[model samples]
Target: MSSPPPLPERVSAVATLDDPVRRSLYELVSQSPVPLGRDAAASTLGLSRSTTAFHLDRLAEVGLLAVEFRRLSGKTGPGAGRPAKLYSRADGEICISVPARQYDLAGELMAAAISESGQSGEPVLDTLARVAAHAGRAIGAASADLSSALTANGFEPRAEDDGGIVLGNCPFHRLAETHTAVVCSLNYQLLCGIADGAGDAAHTIVADPDAGECCVRAVPVPQIPQ
Candidate 1:
């Protein structure tokens, strides 16, 4: 049989950091203005040179750390010895959400709203709601299906006998609890956006907050006055 396809870039990058030595090396290289050589990193962190080389190579393989072969010594030529390998943070950004609730997605919407409102003199809340709804719809439209997408996002969607869906987990649990109004409103608009995004306009998301569940419910879209 053929070998499996590689994991997604972000997933592989995040996985590399799970190793303590690699995480430390990444942090050290990232914090430095100059790229770090294995010798410098190994000595600083009190690890053997061979061990550092192994972890550094692993990080480089995952694209978390950029590698360059250069002489740290001020000399060049055959007598200068082999060029030292250097490691530094890569240009890529890695973010992986296992259950897939995208807090970053939400943050981007809120940030845009704040920035535009500041520049245009519009109320922040107004801009925020508009941006969030637009984002939601776009997200929903691209989603696979209501139940599958919700579960993937850690929403824990459950089918109801009444053809509605109950969310068993609040992906934004902590944020919603502390900043109830803003977060709940954001969540509702996002769900609404998802519905629109998924091209499921007939399904409506309503705020039906329960004691320990998500604050929104997915139901059939309501009829409007003609």
Candidate 2:
């Protein structure tokens, strides 16, 4: 279709942000739809304003935050102490979702793949191309939107010269430590729509979960957990 938005040559993930305070700041940044100020976030997270400010600044230091300047109190005039600093999850931060997709969205990718390939064909290439094309189409659209959506959730998809993508940042690493399977699966679905029916005309799907780290689009999803 229309050659799609130039294929982005490369894409990357967020840079790692390692720290408790900064991580917390990242969490807050991911919550509110609009940007937030340190004071407002302090109130929400039940932390002192100064503490919030410290954490927010630290998060910004690691490129996990999107900051902007705003007059916290116009009534006080320039006569008052320094204006308050605002904090928020950068405009395109990533978040550790509580299953935002009901009934596992990845299921759809598998279903589509299976249903597409579970057929009879004289020449497999024809069937494979159709399947790959369909899956790739879905991934193309999803990735386009995902770049922005993942940012909102606390991630940054940067580009890499290497055949694939990497995360330059990941705020949910801490929150998601326990759910690597689900998170890993999410990554696989992405690759599914990415590589789909790949390989030398034989049409093969990647069966390794962590393979997405490479550009091959090889992550595998178990048979949809019953």
The lDDT per prediction is 0.78, 0.47
The digit string of per-residue lDDT tens for model 1 on 137-198 reads 66565567766556655677888777778888877777777888988888888778777767
For every candidate structure, what is the RMSD over all alpha carbons to the true structure, in angstroms? 6.3, 13.9
- Candidate 1 ranges beyond 4 A from true positions: 1-20, 43-48, 61-64, 68-85, 90-105, 221-226
Please report, as a residue range, the 10-residue window in candidate 2 with the lowest summed lDDT: 4-13
The most accurate candidate by lDDT is 1
Tens digit of per-residue lDDT, candidate 2, span 181-200: 44444444443444432222
Q: Model 1 — which ten-residue stretch has the worst lDDT?
A: 1-10
Compared with the true structure, model 1 gives a TM-score of 0.71
Q: For candidate 2, what's the RMSD? A: 13.9
